[model samples]
Target: MKEMEPWWKRSVVYQIYPRSFMDSNGDGVGDLQGIISKMDYLKKLGIGIIWLSPVYDSPNDDNGYDIRDYQTIMQEFGTMQDFEQLIEEAKQRDIRIVMDLVVNHTSDEHAWFVESRSSKDSNYRDYYIWRDGKGAQPPNNWGSIFSGPAWEKDELTDSYYLHLFSKKQPDLNWEHGPLRNNIFDMMTFWLEKGIGGFRMDVINFISKDEKLPDGEIHHEQGYGDGSTYFMNGPKIHTYLREMNEKVLSRYDVLTVGEMPGASTEDARIYTNPENQEVNMIFTFEHMNLDSGPNEKWDVRPLELVALKRNLEKWQHALHEVGWNSLYWNNHDQPRVVSRFGEDGAFREVSAKMLAICLHMLQGTPYIYQGEELGMTNVKFDSLSEYRDIETLNMYKEKRQQGIAHETIMSSIYAKGRDNARTPMQWTSNGGFTTGTPWIRMNTNTSFINAEQAIADPSSIFYTYQRLIQLRKIHAIITHGSFQLLLPDHPDLFVYKRQTAEEEWLIVNNFSEKTNQLVWKECNLPQTKGNIMIANYDSPKLEGDMVEVRPYESFVIAFERGK
Candidate 1:
């Protein structure tokens, strides 16, 4: 008999942003049945897991991130029966459903919050963080992630409630034992329903510093910084351990925590198997490489070296201790082709190159909806066209500060979350819905739809499909030791993945200009090896100096099946 490894270890996860994926009833909002309609497409793409973004009951404050009920499905998304059908249908195709668990906060309309705000003496009053104001001012000068103050003063009790995000989404008090119990119960209920796993949303931010002190100014840039208190808080690991004991440990579910502001050292402990916290974590370090130090909206062109160093840091850090969730685009991020790759004349090749770069890493790869189709970011003409709360707030604030409309719109085009929220492009007209979409569609859908990609064998979709297949067949890819080949290469991202018997050299040219790669100093073989996969036809690697073409990437199998 063969020893069984964790199923999630070998699986590729495909994330579905329900609102944009597909709509079955022509309701303009993608729902459970819409996802079910695409099960065959996902299976054909070879993803073993589908990380479904929140379909839970919500008021759409931040899309579906703000939840009102744990078990109930959103009315726009359909009923509980539809959700059950989705799970059953997905499982039949060897695909497991990993729900987005947003326990860090809940909608203000949640029953617990409704009762907690009704009276200071209510049983649920302690469920959320509420503090008396400091005289006439807020208890602390904390700012919400969305914008402005983090605290909302309730007139009923004359107390200010902490909300790290939007005011309508109140932060839950993890210190409360009963609150913890309720969270555990919710997890058990889902697991018992036959769902495969959970993708925890900002799980690290659950435990906040009890003191709730005033925020300090940024060291490098002048700005108020409030993330210091709640990010990887004092009691986070303790709470995770308790959560593991109460819920996670009993089930063989794949657990991934979306941890922002988590250092490499912090992730090592959070995902280390022996610690019994989570299976892996999504690190934002790589994603922040393009942003200015002061803020995410402060967009700066990412240097290839910066991205290389950031990814190498995480790959090397978690090589022995934990697992990494590899991704370039998600519902909250701009499309990778637009952000990191060439989304112009070289869009297809560049998208394939980017896929090779991420898929070659020693981590579970995640493909966001339409990512396989090489989706590009949308640049809307006006603020009226945008719907994201963060982008709208930034535009309003910047305009108030006398910033030019072009300047703010440029930032919105580069880093706005709305870029990722656009309706999925299925056709030239965006067959996402029969009716108008909830958000604007990427106009590039005319040429970059999934319909066209699936028809072409040379498309980015096939490259991702082949990459997923490689993971299943090649043991070297799954558990191989990673070594950065050219640590300081300006335009080339080169690395080697090796097991005890096999070695593979993965080369990527991130620049539009052809780069000359000299791996002689690195002691790599001078001989050209067999190409396992590539974005370009007849890629040349002659003698010592290899010329990598514009947005080209390929894996050279020097040692295989030994």
Candidate 2:
């Protein structure tokens, strides 16, 4: 089979949480104009693609995830003309636009769902899942991702409808042929409107098991019985292929599936070039490094070796068949400097190190909003202070279970969506916007805002600028293969990137103390370069090997002849 083009091979995608990115209108929320004003900044940063989060018309139940209309831009975000202008402006700067496609479910207020729930025999009724109760109880013991039972009883229809997330967000019935076609039509509509592709939200969840059997039960939280039946189901490929053939294949669109529970093998079926279903799938395996087997909410001191091992496993497994979208933070994730690095002290050094560690690997790097500035999570004192639906629901769930208020508050501070959703810090004069921000800005804005970072050459901003340039300039870093070097390093993270012509060793000290690795065992000759890029003030090269200072990182260019 001919090799299909991989989007991650040489791509640089920038994710924008539209509401918090910038507020052009003084309505205390970001709109399309805000993004337009910042186009030059993204273009200057060398961003190839801009992945805009949902700006569709919505009830804001899930903050635009619960979309009401797929065709119209949300009034709060501005009109269709504004979105078109933004797209035109972005394209002029050579940046492709990718919009969020939250097709897993729609708000109950959506015309289709609203009509579906109105009557039993309505044409739109089959558009959603409606089942009879099990003798006054739900169909099964499945739990919603938000909290409580996945099924919500509707008195008007005398049936329980399925909602995997918030009750207002009802799951769509993909098995229905007409409903599937409608979704395809909508997708085609967007593609015709100049959208490069979609960032599929929970695409794997769209295909559930036909049987709807209950999943394995858990102790504290109830099991998602329906999820086991539905997620990565037998008919998933059939549905995806249909969409690909009818809508996606026609346009040179890029699709990245935000798949949560899919295995590497399963993901390969969806993303492998031969499969042709999608360009890539975002896996949560590495992101869940801090969580327990059951996904406990508590924090565990990060295990770097284990993290490295997991990443290496994936890199080796998919090196040939599929591509990985390298990212440490996204809108749904806590800041990388906080979660992966020592965000409090020595943050500058560790932030640069983490950036080098991920960016130097063989894959496309996704830079989340404010990530280049080493942004940290905001500290909120109470649940009331948070605006995210997920965080608020978790707080309530924990509180009802008799968890201490302080304990719940601490978890919110550490794991809340609001952590990543906070407004981007642009300047010190309330860096986010002219009017008050929709959400409070992180207090560290005073010290870590963008204007200062951009002006200072040694700041994380410039370090990232160099990283992007390196990727753009080096063929090996973009298309070469990766091998984990010295996987068992105690305090250091080391890896090698190699192509036919050259090999580059990337080493970094992820801890507070200095560390050394003897490269003699690896049989690689001592490397030499004019200090290509280093995070520390000074790196001492003693004879053959180099010692890395606390949280320092370096990418030393090497070649056989030199």
Candidate 3:
């Protein structure tokens, strides 16, 4: 008999960037009470799981990612009681809440970090990675993801602490058994709070090479690529397995690790069922395809062929061994329509097309907040308009290097994280808050708001709802075998998902130019099956040929040997 699939495998997850989602207390910041008020909205969208970005007590250095307290809720968000109520309210609507677990690092202000930095002999000193630096330089040439050196000196102790991200966020020492246990205890506290699961933030980086060797310098920036020493590090599996056995195994919960530099081979071990680590992992390969040779801030056009190749590699690699977390937009990514599709002329159609292209695959689909409304990237004319640390750092670094401001702005337009953090356009103020917002809302909110999308049946929001409903009713989307079709086609992303009894042909025109689909190339019969879903008003299907309009997408279901 076949094994039963987990709930997460069949569920469609919606990611909510808490700070920008909604605000209830008129504080110009979104809060837990705001999320409680939007349960019905999420339910209407057919979202089964809500993967909320970090809402724990934080200094907002990385927008809640730099967690300070594991048990408390951020004051700007709400009280712990408000969070509990939010969970209960969501549970009533059958929407499981998945908390963002940021165990890899903590804000430097965290009690442990404060105590650790107080003295070299402090017991908590080992709780974080602290090393004596060479004369005046850092122990190594590693650079932080945000910019500058990854190590920060503690004047009191005359030592440096590792921080892969912002200096305010210091990396935890997973090598310390007590530190690992403390993390596990925190997980248990949340699991016991009745939360359904966790979406671990850069969890793979928790473990590191103990030697702390210098990385090879690669970029025009003088710092070395330290990802090799930290990301998917030597003891990552051992750490994850321990995490699984200690806290995760005791609960029936969804767990997906955010692995920045992970490959398909690493995914095999991280997500394989027998390994008892995580249910799935979010890989950055496809997301980084459009990134230029130097870094993400270096502007580059989207290459459909490269995107297809990377996606196919992941889909096929984990098809049998592990599960995949499918997503195009997340808290850390720019808006999908603006990045990969036409956000001006054919925004709705392109958004729907991109949705169909990803959702039909054999993996759990994740929809970022506001993506259903065909949200485009924010075009901030001035760098001061940006809020993300990474974006600000890149802007500063590029300017210091004497790179043209226009060039940096163009790259920010395409890949800035702030693009995804803009207030959810619900009304004139995007309905995100009654007062002034922390960050500016996208000016397109007048037309692209949720209120407008919900009223229009033909809008991208409804299209996403339909796609999600189809995933629930169709087994092929969840467990069928995936095959890439028209691999050589430059403008068309075509693929097939097959099972023993059913087959699905998913064709997407990725470009604005109309393309002719030679059905014969698919090796299917002349008889057309039912059109499961399509973005355009009407799709043309003739004998062994189909006319695909600009940014058009369709999924056709066929029976085997029919």
Candidate 4:
């Protein structure tokens, strides 16, 4: 059995955006108590880990990513006691909690940032990047991840400070030993407090490109190669290895890095089981399918071949060397059904099909809140209704550049973070909380809430429940070797998971039209085994051929001696 490996590699993780999960106090905001109240539901869903979004004390500049204090829960979420209670309750149900660690930068209001900004000569000033502007302008034309110039001029200190996210999130000078030590100490502090590991936020961006050279300017966008300098730098591996040695190695914890722009080779380096920096790192190659060469947000139509190719690349590339964090939806992505499948007309069928495609594959499956019930994107008529800082800044930047409102709206509809940040729907009343939620709930909450999904036997929620159960029951899906069966099928996505005992053929109809699958496509004897699972209630099968419905998904499991 090869000892079955660690639980994280085989477990199912669920992400909860605290503000929108459930509002327990009726204050219109979701809190730790709200999460506590929902434990039994998560337990039933078979989630092994609950990767919670940041609930740390913050000014909410980047919505809690800019932390003012790393040790306490934000007032909006509840007290430290409340968080501890949530942890206790989750443990009772055997669900581990992974906290969000936004370590790349800190809020301008943080004591460290304040001290660093007070005077260039201050001892803490070395904690942050402070440089004289290039002749009254920014040091370079490098742009912020959010928008505009990366450098912010400090009138008090007469120096320009670098902020990759927002002016409020000043980039920490990780090159300084004292600042790095502070970060390491904070991580250990939380671990000592009975907390599990972390979901590191853009942690690779800590090491900056010291040259700060403004590379060849992009025609429309001004910056070039800045991310290359800051992301996955020389010190990144050193810092991560040190953290593993000092903190993570001491505890049985799960760490997933937000390593944006990481390639397959990078993943191997970061997650090589022998001795690597972290447990796993998230890559963005698959997530960038819709964007153009410019990497701006654009909703290009998704091609099944391209999607399958990307999935196969990562799945096969990391099979023996590293592991993958398999997911299609998260805090930054829109609902899977709405973005990847038919949402309105074939919502139920398509949702189930998408889930089966990912869940049965070889990797850990991550289900974001409300994804099981087939949540859709919010339909906002005006940009004023948007609350996300990144979306708002992009809007402002485009508008200033003479971009039309419709053009901005088109991008928002296709690629806005608000699509995923909308409140979770508990019922048709849109009452994610008793009071008004900080962000508006999506309108479809009326029909697609958790209450309704749990009641329906064949709903996407239970479909996922079964799929996850199947993965656990069948070790082949968990750790078996995978082989993509048909590489060039236009409307079909097919693959096989094989182990010494059993071989499973997984097929998906990635289209809205019917497709006929020949039995030969499966490369199995007709009487080998029974159908394990299917998205459609009654699939049309004739002897050696199977007729698939629109967005149909099925798994056929064949044991060698069956």
* Deviation from native of the Cα of residue 71 in model 4, angstroms: 0.7
- Per-residue CA lDDT of model 4 for 1-562, tens digit only, reads 4664888877899999997788888898888998998899899889889999999999998878899998888999999899888888888898889999898899999999888888877899988888888887888777888877889999998889989889999988888988878888888887776766799999788777777777556646566547767888768888888788877888889899999988888888888877657778887887788778765576687778888899888888788787888888998887789888889889999999999999887777889998988998877987777888999998887888899999889888878988998888878887677777788777777799888888888888998889878877888887788888778888889898888878888889989999888888678744557678888876688876888889999888887645
Query: lDDT values of the candidates?
Result: 0.90, 0.84, 0.90, 0.85
Clashing pairs in 2: 208-230, 209-229, 209-230, 215-225
Question: Which regions of candidate 2 fall more than 4 Å away from where they truly are?
Answer: 1-8, 223-226, 526-531
The TM-score of predicted model 3 comes to 0.98
Residue 33 lDDT (model 4)? 90
Instruction: Go through the candidates in order and give the clash count of each.
Output: 0, 4, 1, 0
Q: Report the Cα RMSD per candidate.
A: 1.8, 1.8, 1.1, 1.6
lDDT of 1 at 324: 88
Q: Quote the lDDT for 63 in model 3.
A: 95
Residue-wise C-alpha lDDT for candidate 1, range 297-374, written one tens digit per residue: 889888988888888889899996889889999989999999999899999999999999999999899999999999
Tell me the tens digit of each residue's lDDT in model 3 across 1-562: 9877798888999999889999998888988888888899899999999999989999989999998898899999999899889889999999999999998899998999989999988999899999999999899999898989999988888889999999999999998999989999998998888998999999989888998888889887899888888988888889999999899999999999999888999999888999999999999888887877768776578889888888999999999899999999998899999889989999989999999999998778999999999988999878888999998998899899999999888888888999999988886447888789999989988888888888899999999999999999988888899889888889999999999888889999999898999877887644558899999866887766899999999998888876
Best by TM-score: 3
Instruction: Show model 4 residue runs off by greater than 4 Å.
Output: 1-4, 525-527
Instruction: State every prediction's TM-score relative to the real structure.
Output: 0.97, 0.97, 0.98, 0.97
Instruction: Assess the local accuracy of residue 258 in candidate 3 as a C-alpha lDDT between 0 and 100.
Output: 92
Candidate 4 lands at a TM-score of 0.97
